[model samples]
Target chain A: MLEVRGIQTFYGNIQALKSVSLSIREGEIVTLIGANGAGKSTTLMSICGVTPPRHGEILFRGQPIHRLGAEKIVTLGICQVPEGRHIFPQMSVLENLEMGAYLRQDKAAIKADVDEVFERFPILGKRRQQAGGTLSGGEQQMLAISRALLARPTLLLLDEPSLGLAPLIIKQIFEIIRKINAESNTTVFLVEQNANQALKIAHRGYVMENGAITLEDRADNLLSNEEVKKAYLGI
Target chain B: MDSEYFFELLCGGLVKGSIYALIALGYTMVYGIIQLINFAHGEIYMIGAFVAFIVSGVLTLTGYGGPTVLLLAAVIAIIYAAAYGYTLEKIAYRPLRAAPRLSPLISAIGASIFLTNYVQLAQTPDFLPFPELITDFDFMEPFSRYVSSVDLVILVVTTLTMIALTVLIKYTRVGKAMRATQQDAVMARLVGINVDRVISATFIIGSALAAIAGVLIASRTGQINSAIGFMAGIKAFTAAVLGGIGNIPGAVLGGLVLGIAETLGAGYISSAYEDVFAFGLLVLILVLRPAGLLGKAVKQKV
Candidate 1:
């Protein structure tokens, strides 16, 4: 489980996240839904130590990880697939995947995981030799997820995986997220603006406004709430 | 314009270009990873030559002359240069990683000035004689008319180093991490690459290449001074810019072209105007293509 307690994050003088807190238990798919620039990505970034919160603490499995470096956080079994599918543009798809397993020493297991990733996403296997920048948007998103998965992370933090993808591809991606949670029992902390699709897959959800968490409830309950329906779901 | 004379001049140009390429790679690779010009890179080369000079002096005094002393001196110079490079980054640029872009650039210039003065005060400011580490080879007798054993050695050593570097950047784990960091530093951290260590490795590798160039040039030219790195560094930096600062192959091509152009201009035109040709070509390249010969014109995201 991960616990974020009263964290404030900033960029220079401007505060991006203020007094924000959230929690996720193991093996659960939790989505944070908000409109644009509501500090959803900042929450994940703070958790990953990319931009450590200026105040407050983050505990992962009862260990204080808020002060750790970004790579240290990853070494502790947390991997992030950042927004916009930031794959290495010049590297081949295979090379990108190799980078995902950069810290693991278990070569045999890494290779097995790679094979499994390829088997699950055959299109990626077909385009293994192609440059990552040349891949279509959906394929790049898949590569980004596959790259993070190669880390064999216990906690997978996904930020806007459905952004800029076709509706059909988005459906496939959501299905994959659900299947990953079911099969591997991996804890997923998903941040997205697509509240409808995200809540549909999430077991629980939090609604964020500005830089604070406004509401938290079971996914179905939040989906049916009047304010959540009008503001995020556009019902 | 006799063919023999042309060939001799061409050989000389290649010898000079190989040295430039070795040093230029340092500039290009460092720039590729972090967008700093690393103004103090030349000082690392100077430090390398000085270390070799001191080590070879002590070795010669102890009656350890010839290739063994040469090899020992070169190896120590390389190791010392790498250490200096690592320390320099830790002190000069690492702390300013999040500072304004101009802060690191200014810090690099400051480090350069400080190192240059430190060397001048520690060692004599005058030129010192460097030993002829590379002796004459009997196999080169047939071609000695156009190139000496030293020139051939420089060419061969530089070629081998280039091949090794190419392999390091292409297939090695550290190289892949370096490439990943270069593309996306934040994502690289997400995948568990210690980015600070990667930057340190870049400095180490780049400094090693510069040290190689320093020792070879000191041996060939027969003399070195505290200020040798200044001109060589400028020329190599120019070469990097010419090829495209962040492009690997561009650095090699740029160094060779700059070396050949300068040499030919000196040979054909007035020897006093050698630099005019070099800077002239740079200005021409800048006017025609500001992004450089091999550099793409994409807008860099802040």
Candidate 2:
């Protein structure tokens, strides 16, 4: 479980996140949905220690992780697939996946994980030797997810997985996310601008406005909530 | 135009190119990772030559002369240069990681100046004659007219070093981590890579290469001074820019091209314009292709 309490994050003098708070329980898919620049990605970034919150604390399984660096946070089994996918453009798909398992030293297990990832995403396997930049948007997204999955993270942070992808590929990606959570019992904190799809798969959902969380409820409730429907869902 | 004279000049150019390539690598690799020019890198090379000079001199005076002393001197110089490089980064550039780009570049220049003056104060500012470490080989007697044993050794050593570097970058774990870090620092962190360590490793490796070049060049030229790194650093930086600042192969090509052009120009045209040829080519490259030979113009994502 991850707990974020009244965290304020900033870029220079401008506050990007203002006393925002959220929590996710273990083995559940919790999503934070908002429009562009509503501080959704900032929340994940704060948790990941890329841009540590200037105020408040973040606890992972009761351990304070707010002061830790991004590398330390990853070593503690929290891995992030950041917004824009941040795949190493010149590295091959397989190399990107290898980087995902960078911290793991058990060569056999790492190889097994790589093989399993390839089996799950055959397209990635087919294009394993191709540079990550050469992959299409959907394939790159899959490769990004596969890369993060190779980390064998207990807590996976996904930011806008469906961004710039086709509707069919988006559905496939959502299915993969659901399956991953169910099978591995991995806790997921997904940040998405696609509120409808995010709410459909999430166990609980939080609606964010500006730099703070505005509403939190069961996925179905948030899905049908009048304000959520009007503002995020566009129903 | 005599063909024998042309061959001799070509061999001489290659020898110079090998040294430039070795030094240029440090510039390119460091730039690839941090986008800093690392002006102090030349100081590491100069320190390498100084260490080799002192070690070899002491060893010969202490009644231990010949190939083993030469080998020991090179090894010591490499180790010392690597240590200096590691310390230099920790002191100069690492503290300014979060600062503006210009900050670290300025720090690099400051470090370069500091090291140069430190060497001058520690040793002599004047050029000291370096002993001939690489002796002539009996087998090389036949081809000595075209290529001396020293030139052959330089070429062979440079070739081997380059091959080893290529292997390290292509297949090794740390090398992969370096490439990953170079491409995306944030993502490299997310994947549990300690990017600071990668940067230090880069500095160490680059410094090692420069040290090799330093020792070889000192032995070949028969002299070294505290200010030697200033000119060599500029030449290597020019080579790096010529090859495309961040590309490894580009640096090698740039060094060779610059060396050959400078040598050919000096041999054929007036020798006074040796540097003019180097800078002229650079200006031409900048005017025609601002990205350098192998550099791609990076498109900024808005």
Candidate 3:
């Protein structure tokens, strides 16, 4: 479980996150839906300590992690598959996966986890030796997800997994995301612009606008809410 | 020219090229990780030579003179240079990690100036004679017509160091972390790699190699001065750029090519215009390929 409280983050003179707060219970898929520049990615980044909140506290499993470095945050079992699928361009797929388990010393468990990733994403297994950058956008996204999974993170933060993929690829990605949550029992905090699809899979959802969380509810209620349907669902 | 004359010149060129290659590695590796030129790298090499100078002086006072003493001096210089490199990163480069690109570059230049003046004030500004450590070896008499024992030692040491470095970067875990960092620092951090530690290790390894090169160069020339770092640093930087600034093997190739071209130019044409020939080749390579000989053109994805 993770708790974010009154976090304000700034980029120079402009504020990207304005005292936004949210919480995710264990093993639940919590999606934050927002339009462009709605601070969804900033929220994830603040938790990961890439851009630490200027004023706020983030607690993971009841322990304060807001002040830790990004590397230390990863070791504490919070992994972020960042926006734009930042895979190591020149490294092979296998090496990229190996990097995911960088902090773990248990070699056997790491190997088994990598095998599980390959089994879950067969296409990735086929191109394990190929350079990550040479893969298609969908494959790159898969690689990004698989890489994060290899970290054996208790809570996985996915930023825009469906940003540039085709509809079919997006469907497949979401299915895997669902399967990951079901089988591995991994808590996921997903940030997305695709509200309809995200809310459909998420147990709970938060709607963000202008650096603030404007709405929070059960997924089905938000899916049927007239204002949500009119503004975000395009109904 | 006769074949024998060509062979001798080739040997001489390789010895000089090895030194440049050693120093170029420092520039290329630092640039690869941080995108900073690290102009102070040359002064690190100069400090290596100075350390060797002091070590040799102390050893002589203790009446220890032999190949063993020389080898010990080189090792001590490398260790001291690694420390200098670690300190330099902590002092000059670490604070500017998030500053604009120009800030670290200016800091590097300032560090270079500080190092040069530091050496000039601490030691004498005049050229000091390096001890002749390899002259006693007559085992090279057969090939002495083409190369001296010192040249052979330089060539052998450089080849072994290159092999070791290549292995270190290619197959090791830290090397993998380094490559990962080079490609994407943020992702590297997400994977739990300490990017700062990797960067510091790069500086330490690079500075150690540059120190060895300083010892080799001083041995070859039998003289060293505080200001020697400026031109040597510039030339090695040129080599790094010539071989594709961020590519590792490219640095080695660039150093060798620059060395051979300058040596041959000096031999066959006007000695005063040797640098012009090397720079001309660089311009030609840039005009034709843009990426250095071994560097691949990377396509940026959206």
Q: For model 2, what fraction of the real interface contacts is kept?
A: 0.73
lDDT of 1 by residue, B123-239 (tens): 989999998878899999999988899898899999999999999998999999998988888888889899999999999999999999999999899999999888889999999
- Order the candidate numbers by DockQ, best to worst: 3, 2, 1
True contacts kept of each: 0.75, 0.73, 0.71
lDDT, candidate 1, A31-83, per-residue tens: 99999999999999999999999999999999999999999999988999999
lDDT tens readout by residue for model 3, A95-204: 99998988888999998988887887888899999888888999999999999988899999999999988999999889989988999999999998889889989999
TM-score of 3: 0.97
Instruction: List the candidates' TM-scores in order.
Output: 0.97, 0.97, 0.97
Model 3 stretches astray by more than 4 angstroms: B136-139, B297-302
Q: Is the docking of candidate 2 incorrect, acceptable, medium or high quality?
A: medium
lDDT of 3 by residue, B1-302 (tens): 88887787777777877788899999999999999999999999999999998898789789988687788889999999999999999999999988999999999999999999999998999999988876646778899877888889899999999999999987888888889999998889888889999999999999999999998888888999999888889888888889999899999999998888888888778789988987898898899878888887555456
lDDT of 2 by residue, B1-302 (tens): 69998888888888898899999999999999999999999999999999999999999999987778888999999999999999999999999998999999999999999999999999989999999988999999998987888899899999999999999999999999999988888899899888999999999999999999999999889999999999899999999999899899999999999999899899999799999999999999989988889996343221
Cα deviation at B250, candidate 2, in Å, is 1.1
Please say which candidate is ahead in lDDT: 1 or 2.
2
lDDT of prediction 2: 0.92
Query: A142, model 2: CA deviation in Å?
Result: 0.3
Instruction: Report the CA-based lDDT of candidate 3 relative to the real structure.
Output: 0.90
